[model samples]
Target chain A: MATITTTRDGVPRAASQPTRGRPDRGFGTIGGYIGRTVLALFFAFPIIFMFASSLKPDNQIFADLSSLRAFLPVGDISMDNYKAVFDTVPAWRFLANSIGVSLLTVVLGVLVNSLAAFALSRMRWRGRGFVLAAIIATLVVPFETFALPLLWWVNKLPWLVMQNGQPMWTLGWLDSYQVQIIPFIANAFSIYLYYSYFSTIPKELDEAARIDGASWFRIYRSIIMPLAGPATATVAILTFLPAWNQFLWPLMAVQSENLRPVMVGVQYFFQLDVAWGPMMAYASLITIPVLALFLSFQRAFIGSIASSGVKG
Target chain B: MSRFMIERRGTAVLAGVATAALALSACGVASTSSGGSAGELTLWTHNAGNPAELGVINQIVADYNASQSKYTVKLQAFPQESYNDAVVAAATAKKLPCVLDADAPTVPNWAYAGYLTPLDLPQDLVSKQLKSTLGNYQGKLYSIGMYDAALGLFARKSALEAAGVRIATVDNPWTAQEFADALAKIKADGKYQYAFDLGTGDSGTEWWTYGYSPFLQSFGGDLIDRNGYKTAGGVLNGDAALKWASWFQGLVKNGYTPAKSSTDAFADFVNGKSAMVWSGIWHSGNLSKLGADGIVMPPPDFGNGPKIGGGSWQWAVSSTCGEKAAAMDYITFSLNKKYLAEMAEKQNVIPATEEAAAMVDGWQPGGAKRFFLDESAKYAMIRPPTPGYPFLTTTFAKAAQDIIAGGDPKTILDQAVSDIDADLKANNHYGF
Candidate 1:
């Protein structure tokens, strides 16, 4: 038996390694690094510009646009734009609303969509194929195609409310948090992703769980869900993004300013004289949470997309 | 547990969830008609994020609400950018507020659509306001503004002097040849990158029509034939319009102005990048900060005369308002000369009434901005009064953009006329 060797970093190394050319490997590795660095800089430019511009005065921001100084926070930097952002918009309120809506969407979307996906993927229902096909077919019809009709229908949708200790039926769902959350929970793409992931799981474990006197709910809770970490992460990221970035629906459905999300607040800066500084500040503030979420789930998000043939 | 029982329970759970969702969705359906209960009135304004304007509006609302105990006005402010979409959505659901503000140009279309009702204000007060501030549809007033907006040629006096160009005025504006020669002189001077900033980069369709269509009017062309409010046949695509188009496109071709100005064209002019800027009067305060050398002059007369687009945001009573009387009362109360002057001063806008103008400082007879008031009164033309004005403005704006981008002006203008006529015909000239 060939003995294993330990590198200087204390990682184990195989002794019977195949013969490889060192020069080619070294050049290829350097090329990979250069390519990655270039790609990273390309995607990082906009975010860097937004954050950098947020600190500079409006005139300096425009003046520096043609130079490399735009990317560097080198001159006349202040937090006045950030202060103006707070004064101009109800930033905390909008942030709180967006967080609440996005979190609720992520949680409920995962549960409902995954459950439907479980039934469609694991169960032996008679018309399961047709139902799956129908769900997938909905991906072709864009949300804008049905936006007006959806607005009309949602306006007519009934909601139970308590006013002055009496139960009352409200006709329109125009300006409320529920209007933003409930309609987006059963996302079709999320269901398909979950279904696609669930079908790849071994059936033996589910059968063993069933034979051991476990219910379908118990099996889903104990067995399949634990292994759907990547899919769940991908769906959560996808659903949370659109919900947080929602502009059109909230603009139409919600009339009260206090209930509006951060995206709608972006329009508040586009008055007769556009407030470029305050707008950049507001954009930077709203982008932080999304950036954090994306960075935290970076690995699983990429893995799920790669494995499921999904492009984000 | 058996597989059959497990499958049944899963199906049952799914059915239960579906049922619950339906039940939850079904509970919000109660009929909500237009207007509020007897004593409460809902008023909407497009003044959110515009704290100065919103403050003036709120003060008026407060004063009016306190003036009488018969009605309490509840105000909802929407940001100006999405105000129209919100209003349209509310109108679609038949949930429009009892009182709301509409952009001046949309007044005719909204009135024709029964979204607005004719005003019943006292004629004495109505006659005191500027004619351009009144949203008249079919000779009946549908809306009224507290102030009017005007446009002017913003120039640096030193630049004009250096170029030996005569300053234009309301009485004797620069003719087409004089304007072109002035531009040529300034370009020959070569001190500035461009001679004029025409605000071509402002993408708002309203800005395009409001800022440029007046030049077309000056060239003896109009967006549509106003006599019958019918078509754009000879007016928009005629020889005069072609002349205006050629001159407009020539400014870019000859490098007198940028083919596309930046969003900060006024800023560029103030920063000494350009000598002249064609923009609205709102920039007067900012320009004045640059010193007494800043001059506001009338647009050059192409052929007929100098013209500027008229009208501003105005208040209206919805047709579905349960208390139209109270809504009209609030509008009337809000238009008090004192309130109008206060709005004009605080917002730095031209007061709608001559008396209010006299009350404000810069708008007085000999004051600095009286020039704008004179220009507005003398040359302001309200956009076409037909309900199809919206379609006309949009189509004209797109065609004008195409013309500036080097498309054949005749062909583009022809297409614009065809599109406008088709839209008017589709709506049967909007009740003529």
Candidate 2:
């Protein structure tokens, strides 16, 4: 309450935050809980509808909106839809592929970007601001604007050099996991995160670590790395979820079904002449992982926002 | 100064995060190798998921490759909605395959833009087989028809039995008035709803335009002049479209049909929720899946002429390559009656030819013969092949949407004619 009125210009306003011993009011708090529950339910309705529809027999899903006998009809609630997922499409294999790409993206992308982040953030000698500004400036440009140029650049990689002056490049990245995972790892959002987090860590940590028998790289690997736990987790979840659910990028990049991800498989569920039970079943499957990820990481994700909202 | 300090801090963290992301992205990918066996030609299509269907197509592609020692084709796929856009982009970048499964309306646009090569089908061939399917802009055969998708009605046998209604055959299908009474009877019977899936789409647009528009033309309701040049002073602002709109509006208001949300006839009817549903031949797969014992007849003739919503899938080759002979060979094989049989049977699509239609044998649903042969024929219609058709659908669908959602039909139709008039002028497709 004090923070709302008195902390306009920052007079060490941490004291203005409400004390944690007890809440000052209980009625508004109950009302607030009720309001939040209602709002949460509103957001949860479509997902609930999808899950409910998944449990139904194909026909009654769309046609029998009023049949009250079953949330899941006994015979109807059988694993036919899930069986369709496994048999009709290689649902699990695609899911495994998705996991592989996501893991690689998280591990490799976080490490490289963090190293670069450390360089740009802590060990600044010259042109640091200019380089950082240029990176930030790229944020305004749309990814699609760079699609053709990036495609050409990927083709022009030295290791994947053109042979014998024939048409094909040796990389053959199309429809490969490399194509799917590599292009997305270096996102503007991740760079922005590392830069900001790097700036906040006192330059003294870098100086002290560097002065005490450690080289610049060693200082970065030890001190700068451990302090970045929350921020790294912050970037990992934000980056990975979108990469997991990504449809268009993989679509534009990967050209074969064997190479396509689970998202495309889920989308094809709707293209059929009838999209009732099967569509819902597949939709529920895709959404479940996303939902579980959010629920498990709810604390860390929320904590990052709360901390960043104040300091950022 | 504090603001400056915060900005500096924000920029550093952002850059660090971005660079870390870039590093992570450089991870290894298990590369895929095409161990080359010579003579493969690449293909791009949207039908990658259906293995059985693709297998049939691949055999045809194989046959084509076998026919010529110099060529072998490879297949690639994108999502169906993405199919045309991807093809268009490929054509621009010279990345398109020798042939593609393309939309009919686009064949003309593509052909006009150096995107497609014309087929060499003779007038006699077209006269006997495809006069109805070909677009006649410049009077040359540009593409061949693959299949015709005609609209029809689907009713549940047990559901209709409970409602105590009977439809004998195509000659005696229900008139509009009788159709209404029967639906009311079905509703009053309480075991099943009257009808579901009163689509506010092409069917509704056709209902007001051609189904009810014929009534206007018969009773002298004119939308515009023959060239479709003037419409603001036209008779469409009068009663023809209105009458059709009111009939649909009545179907809901009188409880003879389900509400917009409750109109999934295939699901509801097969599951025994409603007596009847209306859809096209494309939905035969769904009805068959529910088992033959439960499904029933197409609706007896509703009050309409020999018109229903029917359109064809056309096969044309891209002018972007010299693979026309191979492309045409692939097209002919894919559309050959034998190849289309399983697709028609398993996927619930109507065959474009008699031989393909007769080949539907696997798991025929009970009481579904009427769907394959009869009631759908009585009211089938296709969109006019005017270049302005996309604009026309948007205009008509908007009006129909407004009417179904409770807008005044006369007002909407009035605005619609004006809108369509402008579109036709813009696209230069002004035939009445």
Candidate 3:
């Protein structure tokens, strides 16, 4: 076993490590900071520009494009665009709809996909390998290729609805919240992610739980699921982003203004004139929840990615 | 351990039973059909974000509903950008509303796809509307608009006078050489960033087809042979099209117009950044800011006469509409002169009928906006009214972009022609 030593900086260093191979402390650290800052700015400029331009009028947004002023709230700025956004579309309703849809998708997706994955990863099943392979194969197919066919299929599906205070059934899920959420819940990539993560968990925990009179589900629920923090966070984030940014599916599926999500609201500004200010304001408005979500789950999300070897 | 195994097996059995019960319950629910109930007629409009236009549509619906005791119209507004997609999806699901508004160019395609039904309105009412406003495919009138849009070259009179360029009129618009000289003189004056704004910053395929294809038509080349509507063979890749492509590419090379303009080209021209802007009549409202200096001129004739793409959004009755007569009644009632004028005034488009135009303030005879009406009457050429127009427009827009990007005119046009021909052949000439 390798021994660890505490350096003057309070960082643990391996006893077998050579100091010569380490990077220089002063210039290298400063250079790294500079490079990181440049990369950060490169990634952040578009968002900053969107936020800043949302405050400015249309012409000024174009006029400042040649200068650094484009990314700064400097000239003729106001909350007019935000006010216009409200008047143009029911922004709050769309935001709320998106929040509800994304949360339900994440929660339900976590349950269904994790259950499927748990069965594949832990249970001794006759066709588990083939099942996993089929699920993984679906990941290679794009959503757009089958979007129309899915739309047709969903229209043929029956749903239970409340009518006149009584439960009744309705054909076709178009222009409804369930149309947006239910179809997207059983994501293949999400199941695969959970499968990979669940496989890493020790089988001893399951055996111990079984000996203690726990059922298979109890083992999955009490042992495996409790330890799936990073995987859950990863799946939640991945599922949430697509649900929040659903444009085509919702556009095709839902028609009622009351059922529209924030992403579809972006189209409200693309009128004959293309209201750039209100559009940017709406974009900035919608991007906040996603940013908050990512920031909140940043650590767990990164851990999941690193451990599971998923690049995205 | 035996008790533990038995207990685990019992739990699994219970879980399976519960799931089966849930599935059975789900499958046992009574099913009902979708879409509007008996007398409720649904109307969809591409005016969700456009409050002014949407207000007019809502008012029409309200009046129509109040005017009838037999039927009630319910309005659903969608954003214009995604309106077509929504309609297409709804059509695919067989859930299209009773009445809907479709862009003029798409009427033929929709009609051919059996999405729309021919109108049953009186011949007098149909004939009263401008020819371009009537969305006729073959001989059947499928849709009609309350107003139409026309394109014009908006210029500042002071800039034109300073550049020594003759003011172009509908009757005697500038020739190809004269237009080129005007661009050169304006560029030499150095008073603006570019001599003309073609509104190229708009990245939509429809804009490219509507805004630029007329230039090709003026150069004596068409997207397809209007005679048969079967192929783009010689018409799109011929010598005339080659000339049009080269001249269009030259506009960017000569720095006469920005290859990619700002999103609002008229705004740039208004801000003194350009000498002129080629845009639709929608921008006519802001031309008043230029005071007496503003001039809306006809497009220059390039060998052929000046041509502009015609038509605007029009109302149609869906084929799936259970109440076609009621839908048509609502449509016809909404085309009143008062509503048309109101739409023209609020939306700043040319009223579709002469009587309607006479009611609008600026569209009357000798009115400031009469030029657009005159231009539309004389020069507007409707895009080929065919089921294959969607593919044709997209193909033409792509080819135009490639030409503007310095691709060889002959190669790009030929390839475009081949692609269009292949599509036409594949669609069996789209029931021509």
TM-score of chain B of each: 0.94, 0.73, 0.94
Question: What is the Å distance of residue A105 in model 1 from its true position?
Answer: 1.5
Best by TM-score: 3
Place model 2 in a CAPRI quality band. Answer: incorrect
Any runs in candidate 2 off by more than 4 Å, and if so which?
A1-56, A60-75, A111-179, A210-219, A284-298, A310-312, B1-39, B62-68, B77-82, B121-137, B156-168, B184-196, B200-239, B285-306, B355-379, B414-432
Model 1 lDDT per residue over A1-312, tens place: 345453332222356755457666687889999999999999999999999989988777767777889998868999999998887789999999999999999999999999999999888879999999999999999988887788888888777887766556887788899989998999889999999888767676788888888878898998888778888999999999999999988888888888999999898888766778789999999999999999999888887876678775
**Residue-wise lDDT of candidate 2 within A52-169, one digit each (tens)?**
7777766656544554443434345665777666655667777888888887888888887888787887775799888878888887998778876665565444233233543233
For model 2 chain B, give the 10-residue run with minimal summed lDDT: B29-38
Arranged by TM-score, best first: 3, 1, 2
Clashes of each: 9, 52, 0
| Full candidate order by lDDT, most accurate first | 3, 1, 2
**In terms of docking quality, how is candidate 3 classified?**
medium
Error of 1 at B209 (Å): 0.7
Clashing pairs in 1: A158-B27, A158-B28, A158-B29, A159-B27, A159-B28, A159-B29, A170-B28, A170-B30, A171-B30
i-RMSD per candidate, Å: 2.8, 7.6, 2.3
Per-model C-alpha lDDT, please? Answer: 0.88, 0.60, 0.90
Model 3, residue B113: distance off in Å is 1.0
Clashing pairs in 3: none
> Model 3, A236-258: lDDT tens per residue?
99999999999999999998999
